[model samples]
Target: MKGIVLENKILNDKYGIICIKSDEFAQNAAPGQFLMIRPQPYDYIYDPLLRRPLGICDINEKKGTFSLLYMIVGKGTKLLSKIKKKTELSFSEPLGTGFNLTTDKKVAIIGGGVGIAPMTFLSKILHENNEVDVFYGGAEEKDILLTHIFEEYSNNLIIATEDGSIGHKGFITEVFENSLKFNNYDKIFACGPKPMLKAVYDIIDIEKIEFEVSLEERMACGIGACLGCIISTIGTDPNSNSQKRCCVEGPVFNGKEIIWETVCKE
Candidate 1:
């Protein structure tokens, strides 16, 4: 699908949020799904060649708009940040599986850095019917950009920064772990760095609470045809691992079904 940029709000030298007007996307986009966006100075050029995958950060269905919150970590994102308003760009239809929404339950949501993008959308939808507790961590206070948005949807919000400039001085996982000992949540959902996800997986008791994690992988194509983004999971036979396409089968999966050893080794 093609969309026109409505606004490009740069939060800092390292991060920006691009809002696009796409009726189809706004109406159909689900939490945790992503878009394969091609960023180029000109349509005739294919310099970057591959479209970068970015999760849907926020969507305004009534306004027919969706936003992509990204950090300028590479050449593609650098180019994406320079794109001007009203510029038309091509996007893959909302790709990959989304988080299963639950209602009338207590849940914990964790996000770190750019991973916080999709969690905002998830929190927004989940909050209307469920009680949400959000834990967000970053390198510093400035990296915590989505608190205001999360605040509106979350029942409780916790922020952590490595530099001791935010709510908690250490990792957000540490805070989440501490919360687990005191509060009993019906479910837990997380999307962040591998280390953080691993930490969350280890901290939770899978038998007691349901948990889901959104995995991040580099993808060449946002479709199952490309084998570039396969991750190993426990196979049905239990003797070997199953390879699942992150673009097609997931960006979200049951945390309990994941092979932690394989995930950490990657």
Candidate 2:
């Protein structure tokens, strides 16, 4: 792991939300990829084990820095939240294959909850060469963060919250369905809750739209050394059938290539 000091921090909520700006190493990271971080001071309390994997939210190539936005969801994250600026952090980064972007295509990116992190990065990159649209979903207004970033890159920005406190009063899928009537996109990129992904998969399956999905699975050894993050796939080999490791093989996969029924079964 490489050790780098936290250059800046911004707290966004009571759940210990914040963005950490790290050194130039993060600039090497791609959109839809992540870094594994562990608080330096918490080594004794939590060491030798993989740290929490945080998606690369944004990057400043000119400044030689990148950002990671995360919520305090566990002991590791809580300890990370307490880290002061200038404190050194240990990390293994620029991990995982990123989204596949085909030039000259109309692409729609969808995200829910924390899954929105990577989508922000993807939107920025796609905006440089293709028509980009974004759909973000949250339980309420507070759950929605970084809409401004997405708006800057997307040609169309749609928001959905369960309480009707934001753009649409229903699920993001509703916005997706409604938008499809007016806009025909060539590809879809999605990441969010399992149910949301499944629903999207079903929709795209019927519509015959090509798509890619970034999946969230419990992982250990983010580099795939450990078999802790296995996900099933439909293989073409005539004699074989089974699961694959999400960490090593992908966090991103061709939406149609995924065995949705098997994945939902587990």
lDDT per model, in order?
0.92, 0.77
Tens-digit lDDT string for candidate 1 (1-266): 89999999899988999999999989999999999999864667877999999999999999999999999999999999999999999988999999998999999999999999999999999999999999999998878987889889999999999998978899999999999888999999999998898899899888998999999899999898879998888889878889999898899998888898888898
Deviation (Å) of 124 in candidate 1: 0.5
Global fold similarity of model 1 (TM-score): 0.98
Model 2, 165: alpha-carbon shift in Å?
1.4
| Alpha-carbon runs more than 4 Å astray in model 2 | 1-11, 14-24, 40-42, 47-49, 238-240
- Residue 139's lDDT within candidate 2 is 87
Query: Global lDDT for candidate 2?
Result: 0.77
Query: Against the true structure, what is every candidate's RMSD?
Result: 0.9, 2.3
Candidate 2 lDDT by residue in tens digits, 1-266? 45444453544553333344455565677877877777444667645356787777788776556777776677667676677766667777688888887788998999988888789888998999999989999888876888788879989888999998988998998889878888888999998887888888877653578888888787877898888877777787856556777765678877777878777777
Of the candidates shown, which would achieve the greatest lDDT relative to the real structure?
1
